[model samples]
Target: MGGGDGGDDSVLHFVFVHGASHGAWCWYKLTTLLDAAGFKATSVDLTGAGINLTDSNTVVDFEHYNRPLFSLLSDLPPHHKIILVGHSIGGGSVTEALCKFTDKISMVVYLAADMVQPGSTSSPHDSTMAVGEEDIWEFTYGEGDDKPPTGMLMKEEFRRHYYYSQSPLEDPTLACKLLRPAPLRALNGADKLAPNPEAEKVPRVYIKTAKDNLFDPLRQDRVVEKWPPSQLYILEESDISWRRVITLLFSLSRLPYSLIFSVLYLFFNYNAKLHSWFDHISSLVHYIKKSYC
Candidate 1:
């Protein structure tokens, strides 16, 4: 399903935030697709990720995660309107950003992302929360050395199970090289999301990745229910044919924006007109039959 408004805006700016154990590099395919589709897209690395990987001291809390986003928004071209997209735990940061900078954002897109309520902290095993697990993939920096500091590096096995399962086209060598240790404090830090009355007025789109093992579709639905979106979309992994998974992934790479806008359009204008009265009647009959059965 589609989510936001797709107008003839001069430039659609997409700010993508990756999930835990992931750096900005994760959005490479998405960025390419968005650019090709005529949208200007940039993926931001949280303080401890990608080019900013060495900025360990700067990445201790949620505030640290917001630093790069705040800087990017502050420096954006005066006329550009931004659509902030966050994946998994990054959703908390995106919501925080929207609360902090309501005027600069056109919409916020949560891609199977966390949609935590204000004044709430992500719960352990909440996949949406940033807590690090004791799995082999997460290796603390000081595990065997006296250099005690930062956190652990993810083991290849864990990464393979969670992150790379869908990246069949990615080179094995490059995927291994891109792996890095995430900050422990950042993972354990309590989320400090605040209520934003303004954000309520701002449009929101939530994309549910149906096959996500970490963020199961049912759990994702619960999160969405807590903070209902202007529009919701379910991108079923099963929908992607074996041969077309790559192409589907590439085509839907810019979906965070396209889907949002489409949903907005449907919600405001086309939804009522598109539904047939007969469909409702048929649904009622089916429901009644199921109830009796």
Candidate 2:
């Protein structure tokens, strides 16, 4: 997906937020693809992520972790709107934005991400998190020697099995090196998310990774069952691997500037049917970017 609009006067812009243990670097591949396709994309490093280097231990709440993105969004030109895409725990960040800046967002995309219900407790064994093959992985809470109620880090050995299992081409060694300890308290907070009265008015789309070991197909369904977005697109992980997953999500990158009501589902129903939709989406995005930029 083209993530940026290249400062095109009328083109669409995308703000990408990475998931837990992942920094803005995780978005490099997708952002590069988006750049080639002509969209202006920006990936933010929340506190303690990417190159930001905020100590994970100091992140006491979501506000600390979410400030970078929130500050970036605040700088956009008036009348400017964005398609906010969040992956994994990043979902909670975008969801919070949806409420605070309702009129500024065109759409909210949760990509195999957490859709946290404010003021609720979550359990892995609960129906919401139980949909996956979660048993295959082991998790450790807090940084080593750091007390309880801290960030969480997955075992490096299981990184490939859980995080990148759906993307077979992903080099676990490379991914492992980039992973950092996530501020668990930031992701698992007890504070209530600001209720967005306009949430239903804004279009929401969820793209599910079918074979996701971390968030199995059933787990994704549980998220959908809770939030019930405007539409759902399922990407089958059966023999598809990373290429297929990227292709499915890429379709969204190209539609940055389409009219919200007119373009919400332009690529939705057909994503599962067209294996090459990624190419076409890129072409369309280039055309749109060219026209506006």
Candidate 3:
């Protein structure tokens, strides 16, 4: 059954966590889709990224770097449970958060990300350092010869090859403009993503990027082998950003998380002949709810 207005507003509240050198701004398209379909969505920018004022270098570990996300999770309404979606390095953040806040989370979705475990010693300090030509670390210009390290910013030049290689040519230009310096320790330091009972309690899903250059498909598969999720999805897109907005719509078809009629409305919000539409799609939700689960 739908919410009071026959809308899917409360079926699930989604919180999107972005990957390296990115921020909440990355989920623009997905938020538009969710808004149209009557779902609540939020994208979090970790410290030192997006509009946050924190210095990245000061963030010595994952806990401090991703404090914004954990804070958001902690502050959601007492009864509200979020479906956390982590992209790339953000997956590691999700892994850590689950240990402390599983009760507030309904599901976890890893989107072509580095799924780090508690004792992961080789997950790399950060993907931005290992992959691509930009070498975001190269942009480490001295704030002052005398000042201690605050954090390193990914230069506008390198973000394209490192992040938006698959997105629209212009998207990289725009996104890079908003990029901020991330702490070196976020990737290199110890962040206790150590497996916890709370984290194990929630259902999880993994989406593999078949043509991903950053994490690579093989490594993504290996992460899955290390700790399998409740469900797995594969995304095939040459331009990853271009594919990101639409992939969720396609991937969600099999989720059975929301009623089919609700989703049909997302596609055809057109008016007229409403009765026929209702007649055709109503039973599907019931059948799925009864037999599929």
Local accuracy of candidate 3 as per-residue lDDT tens digits, 25-133: 9888877766665566789889888888886666777778878988998877644547788887788788777777877787788878767666556563344245545
Model 2 steric clash pairs: 2-34, 3-40, 3-41, 4-39, 4-40, 4-41, 5-39, 5-40, 88-113, 151-184
Model 2 lDDT tens row, 194-253: 455576578787887776767667777877887787767775533422444344345444
CA lDDT scores, all candidates in order: 0.63, 0.66, 0.65
For candidate 3, the TM-score is 0.75
Could you estimate the TM-score for every candidate?
A: 0.71, 0.75, 0.75
Which number leads on lDDT? 2
Cα lDDT tens digits for candidate 1, 1-293: 11123454345577998877577888887677556555578998887777774555335676775688788888876456687988877887787788878888888888878877666655522554322454554446544456545565557766665555655746445767865666666755535656668877788888787667567677888888777988887665422222222222223323444433553232222223324522443354356445643
lDDT of 3 at 23: 92
- Model 2 whole-model lDDT (C-alpha atoms): 0.66
lDDT (Cα, 0-100) at 105 in candidate 2: 82
